[model samples]
Target chain A: MSDPILEVKNLKKYFRVTNGVLKAVDNVNLSIQRGETFGLVGESGCGKSTLGRTIMRLYNTTEGQVLFNGENVHQLKGSRLKQFNRDMQMVFQDPYASLNPRMTVGDIIAEGIDIHRLSSGVKRRERVSELLQTVGLPEEHASRFPHEFSGGQRQRIGIARALAINPQFIVADEPVSALDVSVQAQVINLFKRLQEENGLTYLFISHDLAMVKHIADRVGVMYLGSLTEVAQSHELYRNPLHPYTVALLSAIPIPDPEVERKRERIILEGDVPSPINPPPGCRFFARCPKAMPQCQVDTPRWIEVETDHYVACHLYK
Target chain B: MENILEVKDLKVSFHTYAGEVQAVRGVSFDLKKGEVLAIVGESGCGKSVTSQTIMRLIPSPPSIIKEGSILFDKKIDLVQLTLKEMESIRGSEIGMIFQDPMTSLNPTMTIGKQITEGLVRHQGLSKEKAQKEAIELLSLVGIPRPETRIKQYPHEFSGGMRQRVMIAISLACRPKLLIADEPTTALDVTIQAQIIDLLKDLQEKIGSSIIIITHNLGVVADIAQRVVVMYAGKIVEQGTVDDIFYRAQHPYTWGLLHSILRLDDDEKSELVPIEGMPPDLLAPPQGCAFAARCPHAMNICLNEDPQTQIIQDEHSMACWLMDKRMRTEIR
Candidate 1:
């Protein structure tokens, strides 16, 4: 648990829009252990994607630093930066949009391999076929375009592309959300299998709580560009400390009719407040059911409330 | 209870360049008066096509209705109704709420006009009367400051609020039957809860039967009284909520139930996902659509499409495994 592969310290990624500075990701701090899955769960526009991208060094950090194996990712230069790129990879949300239509499935998967100069000639083709079979696709599928495949198959191709470079870490952003439930299960199982077989670390980001709970060893709940709670998978679901986390968990509709009928859903009132010049205190102060008077004026300090459970709320303080 | 809408032997096909995509094949279901019926299926299963067909919204050039009848209120056949007749019935007799609120609502026009347009056209209310009624409708859908919010355009509202506006627009005339095609699919889970609650409240108050098309089993369990499970453009199972969730018979429904990650599932428990993709509707398989993916598929399942078998009152499935002889053979 102490062997952290990556650490994000006070990371902030902001955009200077016409209206004001859009605080997409503000002062986020978390670390991913070696060979451990860290799940980031949040609503749309909460900056979970921005955080993932920032850590991947796709976006220049506005403040703070991202350390990969105790080395500053943002400060990397020349050969070090190129090595960093080869070490980390990303799987996007939409398989249809992320994949290039004009390119064959083999070319798409081998794009990373070609850039890294990992293999060439017949060897490169062999590697691509191996990747295709690894992701449960036929080796013949290498010649076909992405359009020929189903949504689930297209997603498999996307995963194959990510695994082409054999990166130590992968940021899977809503990887299974676009696929159907049955297909999603298959892809999730594939992800788990890949992690075990390759000893890879993952930053699994999604809006779906149930998916996050299933794949994540440690789960972090984000709201309005800030993390509200971070706990072990079972602990967070069993006893969520943050009010926003409680509401988020309660809001997820359980599939069982009996459970749905009996459970009291804590539907959060109003929409998420604008991230542009967010309120003085807690961002969730307005919609929070258990909001204190101080919550409106003072920001909550991020604290380790329990042995492994961390929360950023005045109530816990 | 009486059925507000009944669809019989419905088949819809889209003539694309590749081939005639049989979007919906012999789908049959009924919605009881004042009851919420959920059509649950994955994308391209014809759930959306079935709902759009109810409003006669499917364009006939590329898409054609091969054969079927959509009987509304036990008197009017929506399938036979012309575009002109559909105009009169749409929003007045039957209304629809689309999946994406962002695209469904007109961006150029104010939400107030969008809501009032339906009331004025459908109910024949005067402009002034419609505007006042629109404000009430807006408030009913839980939009704060309806007076001000109504004046604003669709761009001004959030995703959740825009969906509320869409619901308000749909319910403006208080149609007898409402077809919400994935109404909450685009919104956040918390907002989804709010919209589901609003729909439940409005259904009770308006006494309108609803046909909700969605793939989320959780959403189905939350609001729907009855469930219709579709696969490869055909309904595999139809039953009460309890029947579908607890005692489902179809292999597809079982796969769907087992695939999802349950909140209470054991941490180490592996999901039992259906291995294969849904069969292509272009040249659909000769037999049961789900036979390709079903673990319990028999020789007959691959050769013949099973007839709808009645398990109990209001509980039926179209599966060869449900046959008495097959069940005994399996045992």
Candidate 2:
């Protein structure tokens, strides 16, 4: 659809640990449309964050290409890299740790503007104030330090900072997971509103499935360092194909007591296997309830089983 | 059902440099034997403080139990207990599990030693006997190869395994009351389900009453029979899980239920977020704590505090909207 704003081809990110290489992101391929929110969902340590960081070039890619606007992000240097920085930005998960506690909110938001030379002097200050208002914060809050605000307010400041560069693509890594439920709703709504207003594309990474469903146009479920399923948000939630995705969807406890009592939960048998020197087949073979003999020895191929629905599982094949 | 714990008109405040911060303002609730009660609220809402007070765990000097009595087992008031008396009650009669298992556990020691230390102190078991019991406890919590895992230190265990060890240590003495403060908040959804199931199984076996303090309504609905909704250092509502989920009266509870993006709800329905932040404890409003955020706030809600109105059997809420006269008048 009009050439995806960002594309990842066989992307891999690995960290060298004391014992062995930890394959955090392994041979992942994805594409994000120009103005749609793409959700990446998985449990902790499942490489969702690593994939997001790799896409944003926060971490150097071990093997593969991150193409932004049809240019390889990993190959960019100097002026091209600076241009890439201005075009792509990231909003981190922990608002408490992401923002500098000592800096004023104005300075934090203007950091991007100053780095990209987008504005200076009164214009920069005015831009910061405008961004604060855009994110539903008051202009007066610009003078205050990050420590003076609550978790929700700090997150708003972080969003304002990301928007400062006027980026086309923003990687929001678990932006609302650290927030309270009520505040999370506010931030999610803000994200939707900002997208409509600014025409921005987002790669929204979160563990909260319900929240992700509400905000994302497309959803991808990742297992240990590999994507298991990808589909339209409603399609994925209604009919999850991968065994890991099905178990994960069933595990989310519904709020209504009656429904919760009647629902049959698929409790996965064991914890996620170690990413370091992961098993030599399907990453989810050990915990997948529908696992077959081939699942233990052969890695499943990613296949488009339905219209716009992709799954990497022997069952789908 | 026999009342295992009764807290009446409990008030707690922190004597801080920014003046006395009234943390828990005149809250009260009761827990029955073998019942699972959940305290649901956002941060700074005094849900944790209430649990800490019940366990007699709040640090003093800066913290003070200004008023109210916590009657545990209908035998003693925990508020009046000295540090020595509370110590005797802490691990033996009541156990606590925190959100982060790593911090709660001693990383320097082996998992077996940590679990056995409580047994040795409370049950008067010899080291050898305690070690044997510790392995069994580990197995009970669903840790594989408990015999070998026990000898390894906390660093060797994964987050889920570490939490299981914490649960084993907490249940070492078979405490009648177990307080889990957001036990699954730090774990993954799958791991969270495992922990919740483990707690349910253990509760049935040990016959211990549980008080789970968390912000997740889904978790509360999954494990809790009764629910308490707290806001701005006060309990806004308390009822059976069905009543809270199906027939919630307080506007804050409705806001909370509506705010969350539930998998069962209509995908297109816009989430109705409560408008404002929680009231600051240092300068709390004279009226209802949630009035500022409530969409249906009336004039009386802004000027006067709403008393707890008994809505039905085992259902009570502190909101003017639930008052019979107010409801009739509004309709």
Model 1: fraction of native contacts? 0.78
lDDT for position A93 in model 2 = 94
Model 1: how many Å of interface RMSD? 1.0
Please identify model 2 stretches exceeding 4 Å from their true place.
none
Off by over 4 Å in 1: B328-331
Give lDDT tens digits, candidate 2, residues B183-269.
Answer: 999999999998998999999999999999999999988899999999998899999999999999888998899899888665578
Model 2 residue A269 CA deviation (Å) reads 1.9
Error of 1 at A311 (Å): 0.6
DockQ of each: 0.82, 0.81
lDDT of each: 0.93, 0.92
Candidates in order, TM-scores: namely 0.99, 0.98
Error of 1 at B287 (Å): 1.0
- The TM-score of predicted model 2 comes to 0.98
By DockQ thresholds, what CAPRI class is model 2? Answer: high
Determine which window of 10 residues in candidate 1 chain B has minimal summed lDDT: B263-272
